[model samples]
Target: MSAIMSGAISMGILAWIWANLSAAVGVSTWAGFMGTTTYYASGERFIKGWVKGMIANMVGVLWAIICVEVSKVLHVPNIVAIMTGVISFGIVAEAKWKNLSFVPGVYIGCSTTFGMLALNGTYLSTVVALLMGSVVGLLSDAGGELLVRLTNKKETEENLVEKQG
Candidate 1:
């Protein structure tokens, strides 16, 4: 089977599992999906990509929280807007660090955090869901690779047998 087909199958299965698991845990299913998407979009190896994406996401959440707190303290009409602008700058600026270079992950995390807060979701739950989703992403990639390797091995064996016959 082609790598794309194998990956699609793996992703589909893992996404279904993540959706069910996130719902059972009372977390945001969409957040989990976002996490998985971020993992794949990261474009690094498994461990490196997962770590960088998670760190960037948590930093985004922290920035959003800081923006909220600063907005509350400033007492200005546009404090929220100002703080958002500042925090956004900080979020993108952190890409100077090699580990937090995944700017999209940071943005996704920030947006998801804001959405969760609006819906009265806890930070802990958000983190948990993201972590689980990242795990799913890792598993899905591994599973797809495994499938491809097994298929290739079988094909090679069959080809060798045919040549001998």
Candidate 2:
């Protein structure tokens, strides 16, 4: 239930921010932010999960940028992309972000990274947008949690009063 609410909130925030924030940036790059936020909202603890997810997002974004740049520079075809993927796999396999952060940074990293490539977005812009959205998502989640807890507390207090009366 909380997860659903969190996801909804994250999406809603993204939608609201899309017009002003994303327009100023690029939609493609902003989408990476949305993607990471979605993953964060759906997963575990907001702060902790977001931290890990951001780490993964950064890694992925960096890798994708490198891949795209190198691909363009060398005029290499599909092979370079494959090699990058392999390298990503090797890093994740070795580091195991899931255990360390309680979140799958590897998946987030790769998805965000590849997303940037697919959308033909700039690296710095994508990273900025992603990080911005991530911060918004985290705040939204925190705010949502606070509202729910306050509501629950009020309800509980009301129940207690009724029983006493």
- The best candidate by TM-score is 1
- Could you tell me how far off, in angstroms, the CA of residue 45 lies in candidate 2 after the best superposition? 1.6
Clash pairs, candidate 2, are none
Q: Which candidate is the best by lDDT?
A: 1
lDDT tens digits, residue span 1-165, model 2:
354675577557655775576676555535546645644644766777677667666766665666666677785568686767766665566565454332345556555666665666566656666777777667667766776677678889999999999
| TM-scores, one per candidate | 0.94, 0.70
Query: Which RMSD does model 1 reach against the true structure?
Result: 1.2
* Clashes (candidate 2): 0
Clashing pairs in 1: none
